[model samples]
Target chain A: MTALPKPQTLSLTVNSKPVSMPVPQGVSMQEFLHEWLGLTGARMGCGQGICNACTVMVEEPGKLPREVRTCITGAHWFEGKTVRTVEGHARQNADGSLTLSPVQQAFVEGFAFQCGYCTPGFVTAATVLIERLRAAPVPREAVERVVSEALDPHICRCTGYVRYHTAVRDLVLATPGLVTA
Target chain B: MRTFLLTLAGLAIGGTALAGLVFSGALNRSVVSRTVETPLTAEQIKALAPQGAKVAAAADCYACHTARGGAPWAGGMPFETPFGVIHATNISPSREGIGGWSRAEFHRALRDGIAPGGRHLYPAMPYTSYRGMTEGDVDALFAYMTTRTPMPVGNAKNGLAFPFDQRWTLAAWNFLNLPASVAEPNPERSELWNRGRYVTEALGHCGECHTPRDLTQGLRTSKALTGAVIEGLEAPDITPAGLTHMGFSAASLATFMGSGLSAQGAATHQMFDVVHFSTRHMDRADLLAMAAYFFDRDALTDEAPAVLPEPAPVAADVAARAQATYAGLCAGCHGAMGEGIPHVSVAMRGNASLRTASPSGFVRAVLAGLPAQSFPDGERMEAMPSFAADLDDAAMADLTNWMRAEWGGQAPTVQTRDVAAVRATLTTRHAAGD
Candidate 1:
């Protein structure tokens, strides 16, 4: 005869679009993004959040975007928050064609990833690193160490570390105000 | 490379370079080390090292350590990693190998990631997982490794890139990634389950392949043992979260691990190495425990049964090529419609290899024959013969792509390039005596 608790409405802004839906209890953010939104780019490499294969970006006003692992994260935790997934990393042209983000472009040109399951997470992680570095640039000699330290958390089993670092280094060097020598 | 070899040789000789001695595998018997007084007796190796031998074989250390066409555990195998190609060090009981090291040194290397002279070894050696190993187990593995005939072949220098070429980077990597915490027995789980967890995670280094890594090559702790793409091949999700879940039950998984076959026809590619070198040799009890641990850790309750896919009929062009190849080379045993001729050919239609995103397994199977020793239920079966030298890359692709459509049903047709690439790998491994 006890009253049941009401199901709370899960709300979030993903890739500049607002979403409000009644999220299932016990469903993870990974499950929500994949099952509810049909955005499968945030992969579930290890459901435990150890691999960061399911990494996503969460942005707040006047603050640097942070990398969030969607796999182990709660859907309810994203309530009224802003998150960006791998799918949103690209811009759509007027004709509906997608233009890859600079990070994604760097990945592609450098052939940074292999078997790319880890690529989405790497893409998201590298994007945030790039943005953070943009706001505060570092010396060029420190560039290699900075990029290596930044991208150290994302795992690529293809052992694509050299390629990924190479791409990130090139991107930082090429981009204005991102890094200095 | 020469400097590294000299350093090792110097270390073996207690900082003194021996005169008039040629240190190489080819002349090892004739040019004995000045340090060693006598060779290890056979009785010494066999009498005291049964448990050590068992652990060593199950760990499959020789598979990775043996260099191309070298003697077993001779240790010159080159591992191609992201940083560069690193070579396996000689683990043989020789002055040039780990023979000179004490148990403490070996334990430190395996358990603490600290090698001789306090240098931190790279993660490639997989000490991170080995760190989880019990002291007794590490002792056993060391006992077996030290018994191997010491070959004088020095490990070749790795092709590691800048920063990574520096060992200090790896030391930093270890600080972050090293699982300093011990894997204690889960009080809730059975002894068998705990044993399986230890063997699978630590001895087997299954996570090295199955679990995805973080930016620093550290395992992302949150999503453990789910699945990851390993070197282009999809090491499918052993966890229930995977879209196409591992359909085998605990018993079936055990059977598969033991014999390299489950409900699925064959275990192909690198998985073959695992079965051949490690799991196939394991006792049934251990295999069962491994299966149990996987099921329990994966928490696969209420998993949806894998609905077998119904593939559309093969396309005309692909069918023509496939049918032609199958008729001539494969149909005698494999059957006209890909249905297996029992005790002879494993059916391709429902085989797991065909359904993978990459057809490397099937290509590997074709290149290197699936031996009779790998069959489940302990019943010997006729093996698929090698067609590496016989089949062209294009033909292999056509046959594989057709099988994907005809039998696998849901998989996409393969390209000639995929076939060629896999074939190239097979050729290399074959040359390496895989």
Candidate 2:
């Protein structure tokens, strides 16, 4: 029988909290999130990076938050980096209630999802776009093109892309400073 | 905006001055004006038109003359030059094209770079190489062109600036750059070798892209086939010695030319068009002849290097980070051991880009990524997503070094600066509207 490789320490920030865990070599980010961290929100669709269904936000200091495909990328690759899964999009109130993010609320109001398997990926993409706009806002005239480019990668099997796209566009247009008038 | 205007003014003045100098220097020189005879019989046209089609394919006329999603030979495709944009002219047999053109006029255009009106053509037409075309072949090509469906698409006007738009100045440019006489067939070399040479140098005009250009933007004949950079990618040295060093045998080169894939890797970037538009359509014999000319051998040499050298050890930290990055991003498709997923991605071991000393090709592939590509044999590779935004320069350099070390048997010599340079080139190309 072949001897298995030993686990390595992975230190990173998950959501708003710091995490230091021993993860086995070559364990995917999707596996680590669902099994060890219990963040099952990032559903794996194709298991390859093609569908972008397991998309998660990766943030670095002095850099814009970017989407990293968790199904294909190894968990160890996110070591020492800050990660945000779909669960991190909402806030917990003092009364032990959940307050949905602006994008999440817009998604619900716009009826953006059907079966909701691909909703997390859509949410992550939209959230990152909002953050990016907060830093560097685009002109109002360019809002549709910008929104399309942001949401172009994620694949929705339920064919709910039009609603999802409309929700994101609406959120950006409604939010001040996201799109310059 | 002021700087741009100033630069434009300076360019106009400089170009005019150069044109003035050239015009004065060639005052006594005369253009090729000998009238050619058109004596093709109906039977001869029948015999020659198909052969002409093959010759046109070998010359890669379709790629330049045909616009994307447009009629095959109706033109309007734009070639971006250092001076300005030049659109390919309509070559179909419509009234808007060559409907009234005679055989002699067609020959003159191909051989002397002169149109029906004695207008001088820009060197972007690659007439320097085509000037060596055989009279019989030219007639055949003319016949084949006449048989094309006559689309009524008019030619777009050339968008060259002042001095370049002055077509008369091309006489001077030609005097300096054009060959004094056509290349004669060598009696000493084998018929196959000579045929290959004609196909490669005369019809194909391979050196127009592969050979480095001099100050005049004329191909450096002294270092022909030694490779040149086009746009942002290195065309790489294709000299006989270079091919041998890259482990390309005659058989392999022929296969690569005909199919666009080999043990080394698929035809990439600019070379992709060469295979897709020209070589893949060429007859197998012509492809083999081209391989013979490139390898300088008449017989088939089927051998290719079977093994790569073992990778040397690198710093532990560098190796670790690179491995993790690869596992995260590249390993899924390229395979855990760099074996590559069959028909999806190529193996890294004998990849020609990695084997080269320069990392520009490899770096560009990673940053820009390749679109899902098809082969002549109906095989295809999946699209590779670009990581230009996701990976930093340092991380890119690390990944390149690791891949080179592990599979290419190369040193960990690629640096962050090198990646930065490649990235800058891509940005520059994008700005230039490539």
Q: Model 2, B203-244: lDDT tens per residue? A: 999999889998778889999998887776778888887775
Report iRMS values in order: 22.6, 1.7
True contacts kept of each: 0.00, 0.47
Per-residue error (Å), model 2, residue B43: 7.1
The 0-to-1 C-alpha lDDT of every candidate, in the order given, reads 0.72, 0.83
Evaluating just chain A, the predictions reach TM-scores of: 0.94, 0.97
> Which residue segments of model 2 deviate by more than 4 Å?
A1-6, A92-99, B1-36, B39-49, B69-71, B74-76, B94-96, B151-162, B312-318, B428-434
Cα shift from native, residue B208, model 1 (Å): 1.5
Q: In order, what DockQ does each candidate have?
A: 0.01, 0.43
Q: Give the CA lDDT, 0 to 100, for residue B93 in model 1.
A: 83
TM-score of each: 0.54, 0.86
Error of 1 at B325 (Å): 5.4
Error of 2 at B404 (Å): 2.5
lDDT of 1 by residue, A2-59 (tens): 4443455888998889999886544678888988899999988855445789989988
